[model samples]
Target: MKRYLLAGLMAVATSAIAAPPQPLASADVKALVAPPAKGIKVLALWSLDCAYCEENLTALRAYQRQHPDVELIYVATDPAYQRDALEARLKRAGVDDVTSRAYADATPDRLNFMIDPSWGGETPRTLVIHADGSRKAVSGALTPARVADLL
Candidate 1:
């Protein structure tokens, strides 16, 4: 009886593992751990392989046009999982070497460190902070209305 129950549990776990990850959206790719951006900070944690992330790439470009001084950032959660794809995605997103970028684990403790502990390493997270030290965070994807609230 125990053996049968164990087998049943294992089957359920296996199916769960096979399930696809949630799609990342612009809101999801928006921020993870968000350190105060000094001026206006917008943190986005995303990947190229994620279709949901692609949706927000367009908004990011649009944001750049309007908020030139808003410090936009991207943190590639695990580059090894999507290195080439990430490169292509960013390039297509018009995000380049000159653009603000970081690796979640590689970041030192001095700068954006506080955000790491806060986010608990979740991807597709977002945080927006104003120069006056006001801040907001959204898990999953944030909408234009949400972004507007922060501004």
Candidate 2:
């Protein structure tokens, strides 16, 4: 009986873990920037090597909580094989609830261009798309005022 109980508990715990992020190819980048039908949407692009990504993600998560009408999408510039590490880092930053994606294309430069032509491949970049089809892109770690202004 004790062994059976432990096995069941382990199974439940494993099942509760969040799934790995989906692949975000160049073809799918447009969908990330599409205007929401009614509410605002924020797309955050970050990478594992970026020093400020965690801080930005934590702040964004808090902002989303305060403004529930805003939708948050998280994309890791890392490859799909690193999904485990990406998910773990995002979980630590308290951004596990939103849709998450990872770069899966052979040509990351092309994918980056699709995400933003003028971006210059920077980490901790944010793109805020409004329902009216206006977009604002910001690079570097986001400050409270900066995030507010972008939204």
Candidate 3:
């Protein structure tokens, strides 16, 4: 009975540690880009399979450590069902503590269209939303210098 109890407790603890990613809707993405109460907002869109996405995330994580005042939002382009992988990637990137969202819609094209009509569904997309709500969107990985400039 003690062994069973320990196994159950272990399962519960593992589940808590592997919490699923939050579902991201079109409106959610829009809200992220909205004018913030203070400091600049950085929206980073990435996927688990993209190599450049990992590089961008690493750069962003370092930038976040330096500029904690900046609001960092990480949007995972992978489908919501792959939350486990997405969560693992975020943890590896050192951004597991930040606000994170995953693509909820099964049809990614619709979600892509909703996020940005001109996005072309690229990974490692970065958007710098200024305090005034004006945004600059860049598709592809961002270098450390560019990340610093964005902040």
Candidate 4:
């Protein structure tokens, strides 16, 4: 009887362990990557204090300036602190082709899985999904030339 009881408890615990963390299940990262229905999709993720993120954002900023037709979508991991700042900075930089959006820890929006399965909420990730569904994903900082080359 004790063995059967233990077995039942173990089964229940194992099922619970297999579930996605409660905080992550509701994340909106899954839904946030939708194309804006206008131009090429440039989905960029960043953290407020990440040096590499800042560098990548700078590169993107420059690229957007040169390629006005590109649809530049910005995603920040530190949405609370950097979203507004980023928008303001970009605006000041004459980054008119860009739009910034943020996702909380528990929203249904997430990076479109077409980009990657291992992303699991990694910041500084980007996917350039051309209007044709052809894609290029950058997992780290990339220079403007590199971005242009990807294009």
Number of the top candidate by lDDT?
2
Kindly list the per-residue Cα lDDT of model 3 for residues 25-115, writing each as its tens digit.
7767677567787788887889887879978877887898888778877888898788889988878776676677898876888877777
TM-score (C-alpha) between model 2 and the true structure: 0.85
lDDT of 2: 0.86
Please give, for residues 82-118, the per-residue lDDT of candidate 1 as tens digits. Answer: 4555656666665543243444333333223355346
lDDT (Cα, 0-100) at 94 in candidate 2:
62
- What's the candidate order when arranged by decreasing TM-score? 2, 3, 4, 1
Expressed as tens digits, the lDDT of each residue in 40-74 for candidate 4 is 77877765555677667668877877778787666
Model 1 TM-score (2 dp): 0.56
Q: Clashes in each model (backbone N, CA, C under 3 Å)?
A: 9, 0, 0, 13
Ranking by lDDT: 2, 3, 4, 1
The candidate 3 region of ten consecutive residues with least summed lDDT is 12-21
After superposition, which runs of candidate 4 have C-alpha atoms over 4 Å from their true positions? 1-32, 35-39, 79-97, 107-116
Evaluate all candidate structures by whole-model CA lDDT and list the values in order: 0.54, 0.86, 0.80, 0.60
Candidate 4 local lDDT, residue 105: 44
Clashing pairs in 1: 24-52, 27-141, 27-142, 28-124, 28-141, 30-44, 31-43, 31-125, 31-126
Per-residue error for 143 in candidate 4, Å, reads 1.4
Residue 114 displacement (Å), model 4? 8.5
How accurate locally is residue 64 in candidate 1, as Cα lDDT from 0 to 100? 57
